[model samples]
Target: MLLAIDVGNTRIKAAVFEANTLFDAFIFVKEEFAEKIEIILQQHPKITTMVVASVGNLDPSAFSSFEKRTKIEFISHKTKFPFQNLYATPNTLGIDRMVLAAGAVLQFPKQNRLIIDAGTCITYDFVDADDRYLGGAISPGITLRYESLHHFTAKLPLLTKSYPENFIGNSTTESMHSGVVNGVISEIDSFIENYKTRYAKFIIILTGGDADFLAKRLKNTIFANSNFLLESLNQTFQYNQK
Candidate 1:
């Protein structure tokens, strides 16, 4: 069994994979990192390897105690990837994005792939048909948009994400909801449309905390899996063994 860990911006997502099939999954904040992971490991004694890809501030040393029992591997720029990265600033690429691109290349061979991760910040990473990693874009997610509105203004109240009853928002809270949710949906659709114009044939993969929420709203066809990063961590580790 393999323990795949994704240390995202706000939370840690961990999963147990029996080969390519996911057995179980978890999500917790950094405060619960040590206790949660310890309990998970104790419960699944078969997990012999823990592979982590961190885009957050959590220290890798948090896994130090488990090193004696399970091999701990951190995915970094030094880790071998399946695709040739074409980003101008190659070293600056996030490990999370790199793993996503690697997952796309390994899972969907010989096809152009665009991965959209919708969490604290929405990120788009594209890998071409020839297995070249071309960098994409990043924008604020729904939560960030809502927080920004509340933070920047005095009267506008902070709100959670909610689909607007109609595009035309009549009230304050309703308008805020419409702007954050619908605006993100529009931005995502626009990005997909723009990509469609450039690439005649390519696959779109959406993953992250808000993936499910936005997936149904997207106009383009997409493979939506919130657990893609964890799965990719497992694949990346398996690839490293070969």
Candidate 2:
């Protein structure tokens, strides 16, 4: 069994994989890292390796205690990926994005892929049919947009994400909702449409904390799996072994 961990900007997501099949999954804050990992390892004693892809501040030393039991592999630019990275600043590419791109290339072979990760920041990554990791765009996510409005403006109140009933918001709160939520949807749809114009055929894979919320809202058809990163981490590890 393999334990795949994704340390994102806000929380840690983990999953146990038996071969390529996911057996169990977990989500917790960094504060509970030690306890949660111990519980997970206890529950799944067969796990012998733990693969991590971190885009956060958590130090690897937190996993020191588990070193005796499970081999630890951290994804970095030096790690062998399934695809050729064509990004101008290859080393600067986030490990999470690289894992996602590798997952796209490994899972959906011989096809163009667009992966949209809507987390702290919405990220767009494209891998062509030739398995080249072409760079994509990044934009503010829903919560960031909400916070931006409140932080930048004098009167705007901080708010959570809410779907607007209409594009033309009736009140201030409704308008903020429409702007933050619908605006992101529009931005995503526009990006997808733009990509469609350049590529005749490609698959769109949406993953991240807000993937489920935006999946139905997106005009373009997409394969939305919030756990794609974790699955990709497992796949990337398996690929490295080969």
The prediction achieving the highest TM-score against the true structure is: 1
Candidate 1: global Cα-lDDT? 0.94
Error of 1 at 238 (Å): 0.5
Cα error, candidate 1, residue 77 (Å): 0.1
Give me the displacement of residue 79 in model 1, in angstroms. Answer: 0.3
lDDT per residue as tens, model 1, 94-122: 99999999999999999999999999999
lDDT of each: 0.94, 0.95
C-alpha RMSD by candidate, in order? 0.8, 1.0
Stretches of candidate 2 off by over 4 Å are: none
- Pairs in steric clash, model 1: none
User: Residue 210 of model 1: what lDDT?
Assistant: 98
Residue 188 error, candidate 1, Å: 0.7
